[model samples]
Target chain A: MLDLFIDLSLFTMLVATGFAIVKMRRLFGVTMMTGVFSLLSAMLLVTLDAVDVAFTEAAVGAGISTVLMLSTLTLTSRIEKSPVHTPWIPLLVVAVTGAVIIYGTLDMPNFGDANAPAQVGVAAQYMERGPEDMDLPNTVTYILASYRGYDTMGETSVVFTAGVGVLMLISGLRRRRRRKPSRDEGEVS
Target chain B: MPEIEYILGHLNYWLFTVLMMTGLYIVVAKGNLIKKIVGLNLFQSAVFMFYISLGKITGGTAPIFPLDMRIDPATVYTNPLPHVLILTGIVVGIATTSLGLALIVRIREEYNTIEEDEILGIEKELVAQENRTLGDAMGGRA
Candidate 1:
């Protein structure tokens, strides 16, 4: 009973936060609300017994992303320009897509049903064999680091690529500034 | 009634749908580029919720084995695959966010505006100028 209450309350908060994110015009408010939204969803993940996901959500969703957005805001404008066009078309598109997704969900197994396909498939074998293979108490760590090591390596490379891309985009300003003096000397020559 | 039971039993999914649609609306309806990125983040996080909730078992605890590292055959463990998968997703989401913000920085530098409509207008103006110049070079109307 209490669990149900917690779920409903978190869901309510999540919906409220999402609406708030849409309505806010100040880009700063929207950014902060996005962080709050991540934190709220992290709480919901906790109730759904996804502590690891909750942790990652809180850290990445709320923590690093918020900081990055704030710094980005430093480079860009803090106030959003009010949209000139009517939003009805986007609203209609969203409504149609959402209705179709809900219709698809009608066939999904109930929340937390033990016999759900996702819980039974290769997941069953992972839980059964992970301990013996990796000897780790936390199955998530074992699966992420050992069983799916190659995938995690790929994810790391993606992070590296993104880092390099960011540097390529924004990190040239200081270097360019330093080279300006040399360019002036060449021009004078 | 079974209908009511069905709706109530899948409360998680209903809420997930609502959140997903809300995020989608923000992405589509909002004109500001940063706001669109925020919407994209919301959409991805909503998907993370859906997958994590699906992996949960009603009575199962977290997937950490007992301190002694002994496996009990009957002990129920919530699926950890989704959790592992979501970790990768969360990291990728950050990478995408940062890269997007960096690109937004470049967009602002070039266009001096972050509004999508305004950016489109600037690009259109540039294209028209290029077309006019090319027309003059081709002995057509300047």
Candidate 2:
């Protein structure tokens, strides 16, 4: 019952924060709300027993991303210009997509069902043998660093590529300027 | 009683749906490019929530083992796979955000404006100029 209460309240705050983000016109306010939203979701993840994800969300979403966004804001305008186009079409599109997703969820397994397909597959095997095989206190760390190391490597490369791309895009090397001999000589002419 | 149970059991999914839709709305409706990127981040995080929720067991503790390395057969542990995957996802999300912000910086430099509509308008004017020059050469107005 307490879990449910925590879940619902956190979700309420999340939705409220989302609505606030959508309504705000000031880019700074929206950026701050985005950080708040990430932090709230981090709390929700903790309730769902995903401490690793919660940690990452708090670090990356609320910490680093917020700083990056604020710096981006410095390069751009602070307040969003009033939109000339009506938002009806986008609303319709989002509503239809949301309805489809909700309908799809009808056939999904009940939350926390032990017999759910997701809980029974490879996850079960991992739960059964991961600790014994790896002898690690944190199964998440073992799996991330040992069992699924290849995928993590790929993810690292992707991050590196993204960083290199950002550097190339924003800050290419400055070209050396050529100067006339007279200017270099400082009034010798 | 069954209906009430169903609703309670599936409440998490419903919340995920609402968040996903809200993020989608922001991405599609917002004109500011930065706002759109923020919305994309939100949408991706909602997906992370869905995956994490699916991994939760009713009575499970976290997936961490005890410090002494003793294994307890009766103690349930939530799935750690999703958490691992989401760590990679979180890193990727930050990478994408930084890359996108870099692109926005370039766009601002080129166009002197970050608003999507104004950028499109400027491009349209450039296209019209090209068409007029080509049309004169072809002995017809564009």
Candidate 3:
């Protein structure tokens, strides 16, 4: 019962935050609300027994992303320009997509059903052999570092690529500006 | 009673749909690039929630085994595969967010604006000028 209540309340907060983010025109408020939204989802993850995910979400979603957004805001405009196009088309599109998803979910396994397909298959083997294979206290850590090491390596490379891409995107402009003493350079400096 | 049970049982999935759609709406409807990125993050997070919820087992505990290496045969661990997948996903999400913001910064530097419509207008004007110059050069045949 308590679990249900927590889940319901967190879901409520999440939806409210989403609405608030949509309604707010101020970029700063929206960014902060995004962090709040992440934190709320992290809490929900915790209730779903996803401690590792909750931890990562709290750190990345709520912490690093918020700081990055704030810095970006400092570099750009804090106020959003009102959209010139009518929102009706987007609204209609979203409603139809959402309805389809809800319809699809009708045949899905009930929440927390042990016999759900996701709970079986390879997952059972991991839970079964995790101790014998890795002997790690955290099954998530064991699987992430051992069974899925290659995937983790790829994810790390992706992070590295993103870092390099950001460096090139942001700093490459400065190198170009230095090459030409033009009006654009003057404005940038 | 069955109706209430059905609703209660499917509550999480229903809410996930709502949150996912809200994110999609923001991405589609918002004009600001930064707002769109935020919406994209929201959308990604909603998907993460859905996956994590799918891995939940009614009576399962967090997937951490005891440190003593003592195996409890009856222990039910929530599926850890999704957790592992989502960990990678969260890392990727932050990477995408940072890369997007970097691009936004560059766009602002070049165009002095990030409003999608204004950028489109600038591009349209540039294309028209290019076509006029090229069309006249080939004018008539070249």
Candidate 4:
């Protein structure tokens, strides 16, 4: 079955990511693997009838996020050596959260059930009435730019703020470093 | 064909979720900034896949209404809305990437390294020295 292949490929990708995360000594490998993981997820979104989400994810998550992180890495070290200690606290927290999520999903609807409340209720209305609400043909656009316009606008602003903050922080550090090298070198104290 | 339709309809989602979670977990667990961003990309792509798959309609033509045809409820229409949204997102994504990369370059020039732990250590030392200087200015030596 096509599903079997998809499942197998996804599983393989996950295993590879796990191995890379464990075995790779360089931070660069981790960054690349993260991108690969995002791309695979986008492919899956296409399968789930969530094309709009997949597009955003591929573009923003895999593309933009990787670049930003890589830039930050340029200012730091590229590899993390085990310091003879494992972080058991974080591991325990993650395990608990994962268990809770899996347990919660056990009672959830089967995939793509047309009669599910989510499918039959506001979602269907959003799909059906979307054309009427916005002059645009894309229902997702209507939902993002009109129905949920405020959220998108807020997200845009948040991104703008983040860009500004990172610039300012780095600029300040550069100034300090410049002063340190020149003033200390000249003082001869 | 029947089997194909069934597989296409359901199994793809499992693939998408697994990859998505893997990326998310890495992003959250990894301390390296670049690796975290990579994980972020993976997470976002999973969401994109969800949008694309919804547009598929069995035996349906493109959503474009032929100029000759009037309103007909019987016409099977492929979903086009998600595609349009995705186009816009792709453009935004590119902008975000360039901005992030630019920031990374700046970060490199500033800190002289890209490792999170080392950067934090340096930052902490700087802060500690600054505090010491401030205390000395007030005649309170720690």
Best by DockQ: 3
C-alpha lDDT (0 to 100) for residue A94 of candidate 3: 99
Off by over 4 Å in 3: A172-181, A184-189, B139-142
With candidate 3 superimposed using the best TM-score fit, by how many Å does residue A59's alpha carbon deviate from the native? 0.5
Model 1 / residue A189 / CA error / Å: 20
Report the CA-based lDDT of candidate 3 relative to the real structure: 0.92
Q: Write the per-residue lDDT of candidate 1 for residues A1-189, one digit (tens) a residue.
A: 898899999989989999998999998999899999999999988887789889989998899999999999998999998889899999999999989998999899988889999988998898888777888899898999988999999999999999999999998766766887898799999
Which parts of model 1 are misplaced by more than 4 Å? Answer: A175-189
Better of 2 and 3 by TM-score: 3
Instruction: Give a tens-digit lDDT track for model 4, residues A28-114.
Output: 777776677667666655554556666676776577667756765666667765433355654565566556655544454444444
Give model 4 RMSD, 1 decimal.
Answer: 5.8
Better of 2 and 4 by TM-score: 2
Can you give the lDDT of residue A186 in candidate 4?
Answer: 88
In angstroms, give how far residue A182 of model 4 lies from its true place: 1.0
Docking quality level of the chain pair in candidate 2: high
Pick the lDDT winner.
Answer: 3
Instruction: Report the C-alpha displacement of residue B22, candidate 4, in angstroms.
Output: 4.7
lDDT of 1 by residue, B86-123 (tens): 99999999999999999999898778899999999999
DockQ of each: 0.86, 0.81, 0.89, 0.23
Model 3 lDDT per residue over B104-130, tens place: 999998788989999999999998888
User: Which stretches of candidate 2 lie above 4 Å from their native place?
Assistant: A173-189, B138-142
In candidate 1, list every pair of residues with a backbone clash.
Answer: none
Error of 4 at B137 (Å): 11
TM-score of 4: 0.66
Q: Local error of candidate 1 at A86, Å? A: 0.4
Name the lDDT of candidate 4. Answer: 0.59
The local distance difference test score of each candidate is 0.91, 0.89, 0.92, 0.59
User: Which residue window of length 10 is worst by lDDT in model 1 chain B?
Assistant: B3-12
For each candidate, what TM-score against the reference?
0.94, 0.93, 0.94, 0.66
